[model samples]
Target: MKKIFIITGEYSGDMHAGRVAEILKQKNPDIEIEGIGGENLKKARAKIYCDHSKMSGFGFSIKMALDHIALEKKVADYLLNSYKPDLVLLIDYGTFNLRVAKRLKGSGIKVFHYIPPQVWASRKWRIKGIKKYVDEVLCIFPFEIEMYQKEGINVHYCGHPLIKQLPEKADREQFFAKHGLDTTRPLVSIFPGSRTIELRFLANTFIKSAKQLQKKHPEIQFCISHAPNLSDDIFDKYINGTDFKVIKGENQALLSISDSLILASGTVALEAALYQIPMIIGYKGPWILYLAYLLVRCIKKVSLPNIITGEDIVPELIQAKFNTENICYETEKNLYNKEYRIGFIKALGMVKEKLSDKYSAEEVANEIIKAL
Candidate 1:
């Protein structure tokens, strides 16, 4: 039986890979799955070598590492030599997977990447390394294909997998009732991000923004939704003085009812897009990382909503722009301007056009089976 190695990092990457693996299994059940992923992928029958708890990010300290980096390398080497997968389906974690790709290059195992690295962002030169290591790059955004093709590497646009999981209709009333929110008021959702580092940086920004927003529209309700991985204390500390509702595992539901969303750019921007919610994007990383962003000369736009739309459809309050006043100004503009809100809705329609009609999981699975 042909074996496939699935590699992923973090909860989101594992979730993305799990959906694809589910689709692939339906396409060809005979093929076996083996590699590193979270519980979601393991539940899908992919043998779990290691979860993302070990290889989280470059920011993770040496003491925090669950196992030595060499241990992960040894595991990859062992898998390559033993199962000899026909293909390695690499999800978003480029750090470790890229290393594995380099180590196993020319071994005859085709490397298929599900999520393209931020080549459009600073590391545009990384495409050379990616093309050298990866056999095929499957990207979620239409714009990324153009960026990669420009570099002489043609990438497949698989359409965003998030579209498949996006709810057709959100229970606005139920969500409000469950969260003890007043259904009558216009809601503004705040997503600082899933990481502690990000929450720490942007929490004050989000709070300051929301506080300023309250001055303009006292009736407008502010809600801060927490990612499943984070604790309430983190968000509570930030939103303390303000009358903000603390919610968990209800990002979609929060967006559904939101008149406008203020988020730290990344995956949440995409979520806002899927929900057709108008948003102001914000970000404040370390000074060095911010400098690196400029040094690398990434795409002019950082938010996914802006990137996918091929225009600055939503206002991005990043780095220097991530202030309470700026965020509130953008939030109020989107909330009160009928023309602006309508334009955002129109942009969302254009975005939906670029996505696949079929379920993402099913489509991803069929692609995996074809490779086998």
Candidate 2:
């Protein structure tokens, strides 16, 4: 039986990796799969070597950094000497995965990277390491193919897996009734992100902003889309006494029924765009990290949807700019201004067109099998 090892660093990566694992199993039932991932991979029948929850959060402290390094080394050594997977599939988590790639460079094991890091956003210099270590790169974004190929790295543009995984739109009336939401009110969804650090930095601000907006537009109902990875207590602390509805693991339902979204600038922003929902992307982090980002970031836009279109379709407010005032201002513009909303939605249609239509999980799975 062929053995494949997968490694993912976070919740989103784990979800994408799990889909690929499921497809791979369908193609070759006898293949043995093991990985360092989360519940998603477990559901896909991949043996859990290491739960990726251990490596959560945005930036690691010194102790965390040291501990993760030790853990990664131990896992790498075990996989190399004992498990000896025929192919090592890496999904995002660039820093650790890049190191893993370098370690396995001449080990006679094929290394394939799915959803390669955002080298174009910042640290374009990492292209050297990627070119040297990664045998083949399966990219989800169309623009990423040119960037990787320009550097002479073997790469393929598989359509975004999210396109396939995107949930069907629920009946708005039934969804509202089921959630006990006021059907007459315009709904606004809020996505603060899945990571603990992200919620810690932005959840309170999001709540405060929503309250401000509510005072102005009393008929607008607010809903917070809670990530499954986070405990209810974390979100409860922010919206405890507020009127906002906390919707857990129902991003599609929430996005589908909402008029606009106030979201953290990441994959969720792109997901919101996919739904054709107008959104204001907001982000905040440790000041030092923010400063470092400003210094290193090569791109002007931070949101994936805006980056893909090469235009500011949705407004972005980061760091000091990501305050309650700015959030309300942007949300108000999207909600009340019919002309602006229509133009933004039209631009999003073009953004969707730029992404490939190939089923990413199947394409990636086929490539992995061929490599094996």
Candidate 3:
């Protein structure tokens, strides 16, 4: 029986890895699928080599640095020891996974990467590491193919997994009724992000933005998405001083029903785009990381919709620019201005056309199985 070991460093990666594992099992039930993942992977019936919560977070300290090294040694040693996998699949978590890729050098283990780093967006230097270590990249974004091919790295363009994986657009009326939100009011939802650090930088600003909007349009209702991965204590620490209903889980459903969104830059922005939900992206982090990003970022656009279209479809406010004033200004344009809102939603509609229609998980599974 063929065995594959998957490594993922965070919740989103875990979810994507879980989907691929589910399809891989269907394609070859006798094959072994084991990985470091969370609930999603466990549900897909992949063996839990480790839970990624320890691996997921923001910023880095000496302790964090040490923890990562220890975890890297643990995973690499485990893979080389008694549980040698036929193939090693690295899913996202570019920083950690790339380090693992380097450690696996000369080990004779074939490594295939799914949802590889967005070299087109930032830190193009990382592509050298990718080219050196990754045998093949199972990429999600259609445009990444050209970048990889130009650099002489083998890449396969699998349609973005979210296109197939996202739940159907929720019934707005039903969703509102279940949440006890008034259907008559325009709903604005804030997604500070899945990480505790994100809440630190963004939850207050998002709350303030919502308050600003509500002050002007008193009838507008509000909710905040608490990523299920985060503990309640972490969310409550940053989210207070507002009565906005905190909706835990059901992120897609909330996105579907929301009229406009205040988002922290991440895959959720892409998910909102898929639903044609209008949103503005705001993100702030440590000055050191921001400066590092500025030094290496290849593109001006941060949000996926804007990056994908090469146009400003969704407004991005990052670092110093990511303030309550900017978020409310951009969000209100999408909320109150009919022409701007319609135009924004139409631009989002075109993103799907720019992507591959191929079923991503099925294609990914077939590629991995074929290589095996």
Candidate 4:
């Protein structure tokens, strides 16, 4: 039997890894797969070496750094000594995965990186490290190929996974009725984000904005999306006194039915764009951390729809501008301005055309199978 080891460090990464595992298992039942992930990978039948909870976090902390360093050594030691897998797949959670790749360098084990770092977005210098460690780069964005080619790195432009993974628009009537929401009112959704740090920075601001927006537009029905990766207690603390319907486990469906959205900048922006939902992105953090980000960030825009189209299709409120007032104002435009909302939706539609139609996980699976 062939052996493969995979590593992922967050909910989205684990989900992506799970999709790849599902395809890999279908292709070759004899293949044995194991990984560091959560429920998604477990459902896909891969053995869990370690849960990604320990690996998930947003910023620098001494304890987090030490924990990850210890994890890297443990994972590398196991792969090199006991597991001795034929191929190792590294999903995102870029920093941790890169460190693992560096440790596994020159081990004669093929290391394939799917959904590699966004070097084009920031820290372009990391491509040097990618070149040194990873054997093949299965990058998601079309623009990433040139950078890799320039570096003389082996590369494949696998169409973005979201393109194929996103489900068809949910039945709005059914969704609204199921949630006890009135079909007569325009539904607006708020996605604070999946990370605890994000909830800390944006949740209250988002809730306050929703309250204000509701006061102004009494006809609008609002719901807050609770990212499933978050524990109930961790999420509840953020929503304590806020009284809107809290939607959990139906995020994509909620996105499909929403007339507008207030979101924290991340992959969810792209997911909303894919659904062609008009939204405004708001994200802020500690002043020091924001400054650090500004120093490294290569792109002027943060929302994925704008980044993919190279135009500001969605309004972004970063740092100083990410306030309750701005969020309400932008979200209001998305909800009430017919002409502006139409144009925004049009631009979002173009994003799908710019991406490849190939099934991303399937391609990754086929390539790995061929290599094995």
State the lDDT of candidate 4 residue by residue for 250-348, as single tens digits: 999999999999899999888899999999899989999889888998989888888888887889999999888888888888888899989889889
TM-score of every model versus the real structure: 0.90, 0.97, 0.97, 0.98
Q: Show the colliding residue pairs in model 2.
A: none
Clash pairs detected, candidate 1: 23-365, 24-365, 121-298, 122-298
Model 2 local distance difference test score? 0.87
RMSD in angstroms between candidate 1 and the native structure over all alpha carbons: 2.5
How many backbone clashes can be found in candidate 4? 0
Order of quality (lDDT): 4, 3, 2, 1
Which portions of model 4 miss their true places by more than 4 Å?
Answer: 57-59
Q: How high a TM-score does candidate 1 get?
A: 0.90
Once fitted onto the true fold, the runs of candidate 2 whose alpha carbons sit more than 4 angstroms away are none
Which of 2 and 4 is the better model by lDDT? Answer: 4
TM-score of 4: 0.98
lDDT, candidates in the order shown:
0.78, 0.87, 0.89, 0.90
Worst 10 residues of 3 by lDDT: 54-63
Residues forming the 10-long window of minimal summed lDDT in candidate 2: 234-243
